[model samples]
Target: MIVSLHSYIAFLALAVVLLAFINALNGFLTGREFQQKRDRSISLAGVAFFHLQFLIGVIVYFVSAKGFYALSEVGIGNLSSEARLLALEHPTTNLIAVALVTIGWSRHKKASSDKAKFKSVALFYGIGLVLILSRIPWSQWV
Candidate 1:
């Protein structure tokens, strides 16, 4: 049940993060004024969802036998490439990606100009999205 919830929420979180990145990119390219309500809300939603995923992931890590237990049993070197991915690479990379998104949110908040805010969100969130995409357990997810 926890894994199912985590998987479902992960999809939503990824979607929102992508939307946030695209919105920021549009704002930057068009030189549009960043509205307090819309832009801020989108960025906040992205950050919030990412944090939620991180929390869910932590829970899943402990609860799922394939997470910590697998790593402990097999040891790092003994793990097959696929097992190592789920037990280590995926979670660690996703965590870092989420951190990047959070940092982007913080930088966007502190930005004085509309362009600066847009740039901050676009660059940081974009990188985060890429990192997350690269490390996701695609086979398991499917």
Candidate 2:
């Protein structure tokens, strides 16, 4: 159940993160004044979904046999490439990505100018998105 939730929520979280990144990039490219409502709404949506994903992942880590148990049973060296990805790389990288997203949101809140705000969102969220994508268990996920 937790795995299913994590699998599904991963889609929603990734989609929102990508959308937020694109929206920020658009704002930057267009030189648009950052409207609090639009910017905050997008950022908040991404953050909320990401938090949900993280919570599901935490549960999955403990509950899914393929998670921590596998790590303990086989040790890192014994895991197959795919198993290593699902058990370790995906979760760790995603956690870091979420942290980056949070920092981006917080920094955007404190930014003095529209350009600064957009840059904050664009740079941080962009990196976060890349990190998330890099670690996703693509073969299993799809």
Candidate 3:
């Protein structure tokens, strides 16, 4: 049940983060005045969802057979590509991605200029999205 929830949250996290990244990028590129309500809300949603997903993922890591168990049983050097991904890369990368998104949100809040806020969201969230994408277990999820 938790695993399923984790998977479902992954979709939400990805969608919102992607949306936030695109919106920020567009705003930055166009030099548009940031609509504080809309922009802040969107970015907040992305960070919230991703952070929730990451928390669930951490729980799953400790409990799932494919996560910590595989890492322990097979060992890092012995793991197949798929096992390595599930046990190590996916969690590690997503943890970093979550941190990046959170940092972006913090930076955006601190930025005085609209362009700087947009740029902060665009660059950090965009990189977070890429990292999340690079590590996703496509076969398992999709």
Candidate 4:
């Protein structure tokens, strides 16, 4: 059940993050003023949703047999590629991605100008989205 919830929320998380990244990139390229309602709120939503997904993912990692248990059961060296991805790569990559998103949020708040804010969000959230995309269990997700 938790794994299913995590999977479902992954869509929301990815959508929001991607939207935030695109919005920021657009704002930066067009030199638009970053509005609290349009820019800040979307970025906040992206960070908040990703954090929620990360929390659920942590729970899934602990409770799901395919997660931590796989590592313990077969040992890291014996894990099949799929098992290694679930047990290690997926969790680790997402954790880093979340950190990047969080850092982006923080940096945006500290940015002196609207362009700087947009640039910070664009760069960090974009990288985070890429990292998250790269490690997703695509075979299972589709």
| Structural similarity to truth (TM-score) of each candidate | 0.98, 0.95, 0.97, 0.99
**lDDT tens digits, residue span 1-142, model 4:** 9989999999999999999999999999999999999899999999999999999999999999999999999999999999999999999999999999999999999999999999999999999999999999999997
Residues 1-142, candidate 3: write the lDDT tens digits. 9999998988888999999999999999999999979999999999999989999999999889999999999789999999999999999999899899999999999999999999999999999999999999999888
Instruction: Sort all candidates by TM-score, best to worst.
Output: 4, 1, 3, 2
lDDT of each: 0.93, 0.89, 0.94, 0.96
Worst 10 residues of 2 by lDDT: 1-10
Model 2 — TM-score against the truth?
Answer: 0.95
Instruction: Estimate the lDDT of model 4.
Output: 0.96
Error of 1 at 56 (Å): 0.3
For model 2, the superposed segments whose C-alpha errors exceed 4 Å read none
Specify the highest-TM-score model's number. Answer: 4
For candidate 1, the per-residue lDDT at 39 reads 94
Best by lDDT: 4
Indicate the worst ten consecutive residues by lDDT in candidate 4: 65-74
Native-to-model Cα distance after best TM-score fit, residue 17 in candidate 1, in Å: 0.2
